[model samples]
Target: MVVPAMQLASKIPDMSVQLWSSALLRDLNKACGNAIDAHEAAQMHQNFSQQLLQDHIEACSLPEHNLITWTDGPPPVQFQAQNGPNTSLASLL
Candidate 1:
């Protein structure tokens, strides 16, 4: 599920932390038919926030020479080289 969400996020132009968390929570609830408890939901949201922040920090720490191409469409082939062909935005995250 996280992999699919990551793939989807890679194509979005501006997926902010708040947007991502809300979207994930919404989808998770929908997928589970709103069965998740409030505490569990909060925990999941917190995890996503922390993970995204860590990932963003890791990305920013990379040398300037390693570029991240932002786009509404899927990242290009050359851009995938930075992470690997199989995981386009995985490295960025």
Candidate 2:
């Protein structure tokens, strides 16, 4: 079943933000086939809903427009060893 863009947006505001500058939601509705089940559709809606909220929170809490500037300094010297084994994947995973 296809969900309306406004209906989905009203249900998930974060989707509104992500779709605020794009037409991703409209495209999804168009491409989604009728074979999709209710459970799958609900799951997809929930996932997008959470993502929307997360994005909204991030946007609201960001310091981009504030007086402070967010920055990422260089990694610690110990973690930058060039001769050591490549454990980047291990650490990240």
Candidate 3:
């Protein structure tokens, strides 16, 4: 089923942050030998959700259509892997 971008945007805020955080934490733990914690998971989830929202907005080709306002202005700089394999989400943020 094809979902409208605006519709998805409307629903994005309702998406379960806990579920996404838990799932992402699980994967990260497995990859990094259980280095990720609950708090870090939450931050990662926030960053991830924002990026998804931004991407959806761009795809819709209507930046002004967002239902919410970002008082912080532009989104956070996405994490880049330059510090080698020891880097953690918390450290990146």
Which candidate gets the maximum TM-score versus the true structure? 1
Off by over 4 Å in 1: 1-36, 65-93
The lDDT for every candidate, in the order shown, is 0.56, 0.49, 0.49
Estimate, for each residue in 1-93, the C-alpha lDDT of model 2 and write its tens digit. 245544554464456553442244444544664334344455555666677788778876754333244244432222334777644323643
Clashing pairs in 1: none
Task: Rank candidates, lDDT, best first.
Answer: 1, 3, 2
Give the distance in Å from residue 44's predicted Cα in candidate 2 to where it truly belongs. Answer: 0.2
Worst 10 residues of 3 by lDDT: 1-10
- Candidates 1 and 3: which is better by TM-score? 1
The superposed Cα distance between candidate 2 and the true structure at residue 29, in angstroms, equals: 13
How many residue pairs clash in all the candidates, one count each?
A: 0, 1, 0
Record all residue pairs in model 3 with backbone atoms less than 3 Å apart, i.e. clashing: none
The lDDT, on a scale of 0 to 1, for candidate 2 is: 0.49
Please provide TM-scores, in order, for all candidate models, with all chains considered together.
0.36, 0.35, 0.32
Top candidate (lDDT): 1
Consecutive 10-residue window with the lowest summed lDDT within model 2: 70-79
Q: Return whichever of 2 and 3 wins on lDDT.
A: 3
Candidate 3 structure quality by residue, lDDT tens digits, 1-93: 112422243355545643464455646555665444444554556666777687777866653343244346443233456765544334643
What RMSD does model 2 have?
Answer: 11.5
Please give the distance, in angstroms, between residue 20's alpha carbon in candidate 3 and its true position after superposition: 4.3
